[model samples]
Target: MITHPKPQELTEAVARWIEEIRPSLDPRNAFLARVAANALAAVTRELTMGEQAQAAAVERLEALLGHGGTYAALNWELCEELRAGQMDTATPGLLMALRANVLDQLAIDQPTYRHEAS
Candidate 1:
């Protein structure tokens, strides 16, 4: 089971990764450096809130599907699509992992937050 990451942990990890990558940057590449840092920060933010966001997504999907099922029963392609957000700049591998964790949790909890269809 993947426990949710604390916001502070995500921030600190991202900061450390940035610092580790900083020394490789040239003065002429500062713009690129900032962009990379920003991307990392965005990923970190997503990680911190990933569980809640994914739970909400699942709820939305259940409503859309008009039925309930284990996360295992969800369309794998749907899960994959949500895992890979349409961002151009950075690889969202970590975000995908987070999404997977949330799905696993949802499977265990058998969460049902969908509205009844009229």
Candidate 2:
């Protein structure tokens, strides 16, 4: 039996390829290649970390929204609540949950991003 490359593995490979050749390209092309590599890395992170991040987000949404459902559904409800002024920092766990969810997304989208806590 043969094992196929995992989605994350493919993304990582592509990212590595881009990084390896980025320096040999023209200045503009090198910049683009770096951007492409960053995108591929984010894709890899999503494949590797999205599930756990989503589950944690779902849990936070459930507690904050007071109900359970699919990640999309719960997230929508949470957004609506926040927009309707039903949730705020005064709401217990709201700030922490939001911060964690955002941080998780940043972990995938921009691992080098820095966050300063208030």
The candidate 2 region of ten consecutive residues with least summed lDDT is 1-10
Find the 10 residues in a row with the least total lDDT in model 1. Answer: 109-118
**Residue 28 in model 1: shift from native, Å?**
4.3
Which digits, one per residue and each the tens of the lDDT, describe model 1 over residues 2-74? 4476664666677777767877888757667766666666556565565676666566555544577654465
Model 2 per-residue lDDT tens digits across residues 5-110: 8888888898998888887999999999998998998899998899999999898888888888999998888888889998877989888889889988889899
Model 2 Cα RMSD, Å? 2.1
Candidate 2 at residue 107, lDDT?
A: 90
Cand. 2 Cα-lDDT: 0.87
TM-score of each: 0.42, 0.90
What's the distance in Å from true for residue 106, model 2?
1.4
